[model samples]
Target: MHKSIAIIYNQPAASPYRDRNEQSAEDGVLVEVAAVEKALHFLGYLTSKIPLALPLEQAFSELSLITADIVFNLFEGFSGFPETEALIVEQLEALKLRYTGSPAAALKLALDKAETKTVLKQEGILTPAFQLLDNATLSDFKLNFPCIVKPNAEDASHSLNVKSVVYDYDALKDMVSEISGMYGKKALVEEYIDGREFNMTIMGNNILTTLPISEICFSLPQDT
Candidate 1:
């Protein structure tokens, strides 16, 4: 029997903020959807593409009409509302549908950088010293100089730029304020390690397999 799969993904749209870049930074999702659909077709599985949009109810209504053995969840939430990413997974769970990638709870936890780091610290994992700050809070400078400030609950390097790294309390405060004002969310200030950055992706459950490590090389000025 051929299994049916639904490729659920969010179509890129323009943001309301005029100051923000209007060009769809996430246009790559279209390519990803095409690639996944093609691969699934080659694998002999029936596939359907579902493009999600705002007001979620419309997407859910469309999903109700589809019957698939599994949903290849690619929804990364609307452009600005990153918090809704986990809600998509939760909806799938509520409908008793199996989907790929992290579950709703894990997605929610991971989205909150400070909470995720706290859990890691409790588990004795080595992590940089960090603090969560909102618009009204002042920086205590708990972390060392050359710290990085980022949105607490956003991914894909949202609201991040060269100025995100600060070398002093004043710079940290300005960066934190800028991030909070821009993203309208709490900022996570953490110690910045000025060295090589590596990322490792682990796949599978029970029997785990690690993918090749990837490194990021910066070409811009270090103090930018």
Candidate 2:
């Protein structure tokens, strides 16, 4: 019998940024859902699309009703609530359903930049020193100048922009305040690494294989 799959995802909405020319950050989820649905169809598996949203119990009920053998688990979270991304996986686990991607605990850890850095440090991995700051404790930040500030629990550069990098204490405070106020979360202030950057994609659980590394080159100025 052919296996069935559910292409779950967080549906894309209008771009929150003022620049209308830019696409929505959630667009990738839709793209992945479409691509996966098509590929599974070609492979002779029945597929269904499940767009996750508010009233998650309703979504969960729908998921349970679906006869799919497994879920692709592309749901990233409802709009403006990136921190809830892991909850979707948690629900899947409760349902005793098979799904793809990282587990809920891993998802939660990866979402919190400060906690992730702490774990990495404990493992003897070289990670930049960082501090988690909120409006109540902004005055306590003592990191070196030229630090990068970002939403503590958000992914996909939710509130990150050119202004995320700060050169002075005032700029750092302002950026941290902006992140906390806008994203409604603590800000992660980390020492900025002034050097080339690269992205390496690792796959597989038992035997991890690193894909080709791609160097990140910014066309804009260094301070931008």
Candidate 3:
């Protein structure tokens, strides 16, 4: 018998503050949803796509009604509500539903980049030196120039642009202030390293499978 699978994802919220970059990021999830649905069909599983949005009660109520053997959680969550991603997973757990993707604990931990970096540093894993600035105070700035500033808890490169990368204190201050003012959160300033970017995807829980290393090719200017 083919088992049913529920594919849950966050319905992108439209906001005046969301620019082209943010919209682009949110839109990519639609592509991901289609790809996952196709893959599940090929695997001979009954599939359903559930798009969840604001008003947490409605989302949770919808979740309680799911009748699937497994859930493929593709929820990247909505802006300003980063905790929603983990909360959905937690709900699944409470209902004792089998689901794909990381657990709520891991999702919560990974959402905070500063905390993730601190964990990596404690584990002796080499990571770029970063400072978490809550109020744009550079009085204790110790990192060298050529740094990138990002919202402490945001994903999908939201609010990131050409100006995100800075080479001077003035630019750094501006970027930090922007992140704080826009996201109402701390800014993460990390030492920038100019080079190609790569992603290593690993899947599974009990037995993990590491996929091929994927490199990100940039066609834009070096500064960008």
Ranking by TM-score: 3, 1, 2
Model 2 stretches with alpha carbons more than 4 Å out: 13-23, 215-217, 220-224
**How does each model score on TM-score?**
0.90, 0.87, 0.93
Highest TM-score model number: 3
Instruction: Give the per-residue lDDT of model 2 (tens digit) for 1-224.
Output: 89988888876665453242324667767777778888889999988888866777777777677568998888887666666688888888888888888889999999888888899999999998898898899888888878999888877767677899999988987898888887677888999988988998887789998899999886879787
| Candidates sorted on lDDT, descending | 3, 1, 2
Of models 1 and 2, which has the larger TM-score?
Answer: 1
Compose the digit string of candidate 1's lDDT tens values, residues 83-182.
7799888888888888888889999999989999999999999999988886577645566778899889877766677888889877888888888887
What local lDDT score does residue 74 receive in model 2, on the 0 to 100 scale?
86
Cα deviation at 165, candidate 1, in Å, is 0.6
Clashes of 2: 0
